[model samples]
Target: MTVRISAPSGPFRDAGIEALREGLTRRGLLGCGAGAAGAVLLGAAGDARSQDAVQPHALAEFFQGHQVAGAALSPSGERVAVLLNIGEGGARRMAVDLIEAADPSGPRRRVPVGDFDVETLAWANEQRVMMRLVIPVTAGGNTPTGRGIANRTYELQSRRVVSMDLETGETALMFGDERVRMRESLNLGHIVDYLPDDPDHVLMAAREFSGLMALHRVNVNTGRADLVERGSQLTLDWSTINGVPVMRRDISTRGSVINIFVRPDGEGRWRRAWRQPTAQVALADFIWIGAAERAGHALVAARIEDEDVLAVRELNLDTLEYGPPMASRAGLDVSASLVDARGRYMAAAFYAPRLEYDFVDSDLGAHHRAMNGFFGNECNVVLANADAAHNRFIIRASGPRDAGSWYLYDKAARHFEYLGARTLLDTRRLAPAEAVQVATRDGASIEAYVTAPPGGAPGPVIALVHGGPESRDVLGWDRQAQVLAAQGWWVVQPQFRGSGGYGLAFASQGWKRWGDRMQEDVEDALAQIIRDRGLDAARVGIMGTSYGGYAALMGAVRRPDLYKAAISICGLGDLGDALAYERRDDESADGFVYDYWTSRIGDPRTDGDAIAAASPRLRAAEIACPVLLVHGVDDPIVQVHQSRGMNDALQAAGKPVEYVEVPGAGHADWEDDVEKDLMERYVALFSRAFA
Candidate 1:
């Protein structure tokens, strides 16, 4: 279901920066050239020595694609299906490895799907697992084929969901009704619920030609759907409690308010229990997770005015009131609620800038903590999936020095068996990260992570601003951070304001204050780290993607004294021009997209003064450092124009700027072979800049 980003991050951008807006299905399957699935890469007993034995010079190859694209736990939790990438470069072939939870090292099942980029892997039932992927529908959007309908050519991405029998390896396409193809919905394969209770069917949501959001109970085997409910324009995500349709979240047509409603029973009247404006100030962060055991009771994650940190709480459906905190981590805010198959809250997950979970079930929590101890506590231990009886779990453990590996953990037997590595990189070479807090203007404090060269010697530094100005930096095995660190530069990712997961008050201060307060927070963190780490100030360079890219260019424009070099990958140049693009010929202005961008960033139509003061392209004359711009030619999110305009502005101002136009690339090219080459280019440029 499409959840309105309480705080939209990349691909979740509220119509703000198209570049930040991710497609409904971004499974890393760029248009074409996916080879046949005839070749198998990894299996139950596959050797990972090749992945682990990556040569020092070939370390960048690890950044090409994910070794473990995704992992799904079977309904019975007896088996964990892992999607492993085969071969090299962007469009790597994929194979599914079904490892036994009892003994992962033993013989298991391997199913290969050649050239298909499987974005998410989920269990349709105990005997079935389904994969969601994007298909290149070249030729035309509405072309008729004997098999089915052909969506828009490469101009727009089409999606397909495949259901496979774990035992037989036979696969079927989901949403397979030819009867509904002519209806012309935007996203055809939108899955809502897996329906563990009803293994034959799952809930799906699709926007019809009438612009109404409808829920369908589709048989995974037959692909026939029966319409369950059709909602209004304001009403968006449709959700189910257990196997019953009982909840729906809506954003006002104006996009200023968010309303959450729950049904006492599937047939009962809708009750409004939560309402909050999109504004960051004076906000009450509440998200409906699942229905509680009681008829009118529900579980939710809330960060109210009294406490900025999120905690799991009980919401009374009848009285529309929240009960006491059911589960919370002291001093740390909860990022998500971990629920069981029956939709009961079992734990609260937070990022101490890393993966940390607090289980409500004391025994489970203790066992999880024990697993962490078994991993030496340096690695992040997560119970990715568990059996119906909670007797076994799929454990994922990773750290800065570890690429991460899956484990089969037997709770009853207290046994842990290694499954496989999560990536192809030899992560043991990554530098350890240190957390630091720096005070900025207005008595505000910011948290950041600094990874210096392993030798502890002071050297050049690079301030990597994270994307989603709404998105905050997370701690763990960071690929981008490690890539630059490998080049002997100190990298500090500041958890700047307006970034999510830091409570609303802190994040609210960042709303619509970009290029000023938010920019100051980033600069303050870098200044403090430079002083403390003794990094050479003259050699410092700033870099980032999307919003981070915007920030990178703006940093050089506003404070050239701090940066000697800058690089912006697919970054936006003009904030005002970007928002203006979102508002042009688009859907109603009242929609979330238009409101989200205008709300987060000032509207160019009305906030011209504010936008002009912040736009890097408009003030290119002020940028004094050598800058670099890189963009994907086929990027649908943020079009190539943004980077092109930025490069034009810099060159017009007689500034030193190098522009790299990546052919056949989109918003994210991590899976593409060029990613490695581009990464190497970055290291070289910084090497020369800091020389």
Candidate 2:
């Protein structure tokens, strides 16, 4: 059997993602594409897309196998480290594979990772590989959750750092064998800084059973972590110089208020540098993106007193003063910087929905630009990693047609070898997405993607809202959106104000808006699409996952006249229950996640009226259209009860509803068969609704 798998481009990049991304781009997507997936997949069928006709598996192909999300090159550039889809049918999972960079088809070592999924990869050296992995945890009866033995309890995702030896393929959890509570604060991985200069050690923050995240210098090979500095209860992450912790960023336990502190050296007294609020939904502190060109000067992210957006500044590490602006995006916040093997800043990067870099290193910058141009500049091209000599390189690219693919570049040879595509493609049905800027009711314009079948004209429309409330949809190859487009419906993904990456004024206002302005934002975007495309507004429907799912349900209740149908997947039905659930399962009362939610969303204890007003389950009868609610039975984040209760409420109200609880599925991801089932149900629901 031949199996094809691909990568994930996301609305929610997860914890420390910006750091991981910038680090990997400097070192290693689907690692950021076009040759062939030379990697092997176990127990898979023939090419479903190769059939003359559009097979039933065209959409199902998305769920069939896992794909490589990203990859990196070894320090010596001798081998490539990337996770690939490897397992039997339906149960397929991601595992690490070390293949010779110069000879991928030659000798290789496969590291079986069991059920855990590899999120990102780096190298301790040429022989040892390090990774950030998320291991699924199912909490139940008689557990620390304090739930009844009869109650099924589970945590959303349990993330940890793991290291593997290429010689023996032995893997160990880098944090040690301590059994800590599931609800560790984001600081556990909040600031994972991979040291480019130090080959054997990676600096990160980890939490104990209680207290603030302490800085640890972890040995990449021995799985030994040495405590470097213990932080305060509010300490989020620390900045370092020559392996010594010198600065730190601390956030208020209950709100978005953040404090920045720094010292003259590792042992100096800490003093306040500044205070800032998370005014942006996707706020990133790139204060020290990379090492500066000159000694004693480091590249830092700073916002001038009068400026609204952050820019790149050469920070004087000694006096702690900002130098002149090195790069600014005018209105957008700078999120990351590109540094090469020599520890030189190549470019400054920000999410323009697509990654746009302000190149400082002209030679490498031109090479990157040329790569993008070669792919028509319509796709995202990233320089994944490079050798110390800066000769061999890894390149990744993804587009509307291509899910994602990797290429090996022999810079000295001026050659690129296609490694493989990230996702399994149904070439016969792949669709293109056009980025559209639509205006909200408040007269503010937001970006959205309008996806359609090949040469497809606007007709029946489906609004695809992204989750994360703070998570923003990007202009990338999205499988679900593409599948919906293959169904012959114009799928429009709205980057609502609550969504991030736009700017301050755009996302800040939507923080507490929930079913109010947030719902209105989706409504406004859909209305604009209908008007601009001259499509039948009556046939429009709304759907999403997590927070996106909540918006869909609210769409049915708020504007039944506009949306004829709705689909909510693992969505929150009651805001109050969600808050209570998090609080109950919380390992630390000071966790910013619980506090972040309450700060943006009012505390359910005190804001019952507002909570009830926005809850879809609380107002089930208000919905006039047929609704579909799909949730993972083992989902620990939003909990399956949220959907079940909504189902019961709709049934009691005599409203049409369909509900499904997928067994063994969790909030973060689903198994292959489960994903296939989901696609089928989604298509069936839309078919009946629009017919």
C-alpha lDDT values of all predictions: 0.70, 0.69
Per-residue lDDT of 199-219 in model 1, one digit per residue for the tens? 998888766667778888888
TM-score of each model, paired residue for residue: 0.77, 0.72
Candidate with top lDDT is 1
Query: Model 1 Cα displacement at 662 (Å)?
Result: 7.1
Count clashing residue pairs per candidate: 12, 16
- The per-residue C-alpha lDDT of model 2 at residue 551 equals 93
